[model samples]
Target: MIIAKIALELTDLLVCAGVFLVGSVISFFLFHVALRRKREKLISEAEAEAEVLRKEKILQAKEKFFQLKAEHEKYIGEKNNKITQSENR
Candidate 1:
């Protein structure tokens, strides 16, 4: 009768251990899923910021190009006026 009691106790212990292991696996799986979602959100935000910066850089370059073009045209017009005055004199 003592041996039967011991055997029942052992069975209960095994069942408890199995339940604990399954719970641990489920907890780990949920934690990993939450972590992956957070990581993806951060990556998406970074990509959006990078796209805005790229657009800003392109706009700045275009403005600089227009300024330089205007200066070059003004310089050419001044040179032409000087040449015409010299020819008249």
Candidate 2:
């Protein structure tokens, strides 16, 4: 009878240990999947932000170029006017 009781206890302990190991493995897998998804989301958001910044910088550069072009054209017009006035005099 004592031997039978010892065997039963050993079996219960092994079952509990097996359950604990399986639970741990499942938990690890779930956490790994969640973290991977979060990482992907962060990477996508960063890429989108970079694209927006690139577009804004391009627009600002174009605006600056147009402003400079207008200034140059005005300067040339003023010089032409001066030449015409001197010729008429």
Candidate 3:
């Protein structure tokens, strides 16, 4: 009878252990899913910021190009005026 009682106790212990193991596995899966979502959000935000920076850089470059073009045209105009004056003299 004592042996039967011990066997029953052992079975109960094993069942409890199995329950604990299953709970742990479920928790681990939930934690991993949450972390994956967080990582994706961070990556998306970084990509958006990078796109904004790229657009700003392009706009700055275009503005600089226009300024340089205007300066070049002014220089050419001045040179032409000087040559014409000298030829008239």
Candidate 4:
């Protein structure tokens, strides 16, 4: 009877250990999947933000170019007027 009890207890302990191992493996896989999803989300968000900043920089550069072009045209016009006046005199 004592030997039977010992065998039963060993079987129960082995079943419990198997269940624990399986549970741990499942939980680890789930955690890894969750972390991967989070990393992908963060990367996507960062790319989107970078795109927005690139567009903004392009727009600002275009505005500055136009402003510089207008100023250069005005300067040329003034120089031409001065030359014409000097020639007339």
Q: Please, what is the TM-score per model?
A: 0.86, 0.88, 0.87, 0.94
lDDT of each: 1.00, 1.00, 1.00, 1.00
User: Is 1 or 4 the stronger prediction by TM-score?
Assistant: 4
Clashing residue pairs in candidate 3, if any?
none
lDDT of 3 at 65: 100
**TM-score of the candidate numbered 2?**
0.88
| lDDT tens digits, residue span 1-89, model 1 | 99999999999999999999999999999999999999999999999999999999999999999999999999999999999999999
By TM-score, rank the candidates, best first. Answer: 4, 2, 3, 1
Let me know the TM-score candidate 3 reaches against the reference structure: 0.87
RMSD of each candidate? 1.5, 1.3, 1.4, 0.9
Expressed as tens digits, the lDDT of each residue in 1-89 for candidate 3 is 99999999999999999999999999999999999999999999999999999999999999999999999999999999999999999
> By the TM-score metric, which is better: model 3 or model 4?
4
- Clash totals in order: 0, 0, 0, 0
Residue-level lDDT of model 4, residues 1-89, one tens digit each, is 99999999999999999999999999999999999999999999999999999999999999999999999999999999999999999
